[model samples]
Target: MTPRSIDEITARADEFADMFEGYDPKPGDLDAPVPPVMAVKLAAWRRDVAERELADAVRAAREQRLSWREVGNAIGTSGEAARQRYGATA
Candidate 1:
């Protein structure tokens, strides 16, 4: 599959959410007609897009000389924790 943009992934996720709305009363839903392979493809696409976006954000944050405190706050972690996790890599 081709690389997908964040917007495309978000849009497809939204579509999947819509598809499951008020699904059914049965326990299995296994008889449902959705393509099982589509779920796998979407999950892989999401992981790729998320990683790219995270790398870009880390690069931008480092370029701005923003503190690990700020980044960690945004990520719900301690500054030291954030640095240990991503600083050198960033």
Candidate 2:
């Protein structure tokens, strides 16, 4: 897959922010109901974006000669764990 440009990522982030900004619940409406499927789909979309960004970052780090240990430390995982998770994609 082609890597996303910084501009593209920024635009997407802004779009996500806008989504939340538009969804502010009314004051004192503690029991406001949201569609269950909407929540599920939003969560899935966020996960998809996160995984794509992570794969891109891992590939870039490998290209820059960064060790898996360094990547692991940055991502709060063990070196072997990072390798096992991202090696094939990187």
Candidate 3:
């Protein structure tokens, strides 16, 4: 099968969220394996969400004039390393 497009993945996640909307999963439900197709869709959805969140955080940090040194300290990394990883964008 072909890989799903991002829009398709997001739609699938939205559908899945609706399935469990306003309900918490029990322990067994949490550990249950979703259908393989759903699993793939969920993984894609999760990755997209994480990437968006990371980008948003970077933008916010930059907007706040947060330095790599401060970010690194908060994340338990060295100032230099954080600068190397995130300074260019900031």
Give RMSD (Å) of candidate 3 vs. truth: 9.8
Query: Against the hidden true structure, what lDDT does model 2 obtain?
Result: 0.93
Compose the digit string of candidate 1's lDDT tens values, residues 1-90. Answer: 999999999999999998889566687667666577997898899999987787678668978998889888877889898788777778
Q: Give lDDT tens digits, candidate 3, residues 1-90.
A: 999999999999999898889687777987887999999999999999985676577667868988767777866788788777766666
Against the hidden true structure, what lDDT does model 1 obtain?
0.83
Instruction: Report every candidate's CA lDDT.
Output: 0.83, 0.93, 0.79
Off by over 4 Å in 2: 1-33
- Higher-scoring candidate on TM-score, 1 or 3: 1
Model 1 bad stretches (over 4 Å): 1-34
Q: Which residue pairs collide, candidate 2? A: none
Cα deviation at 74, candidate 1, in Å, is 1.2
Error of 3 at 73 (Å): 4.5
What is the full ranking by TM-score, best candidate first? 2, 1, 3
- 1 or 2, greater by TM-score: 2
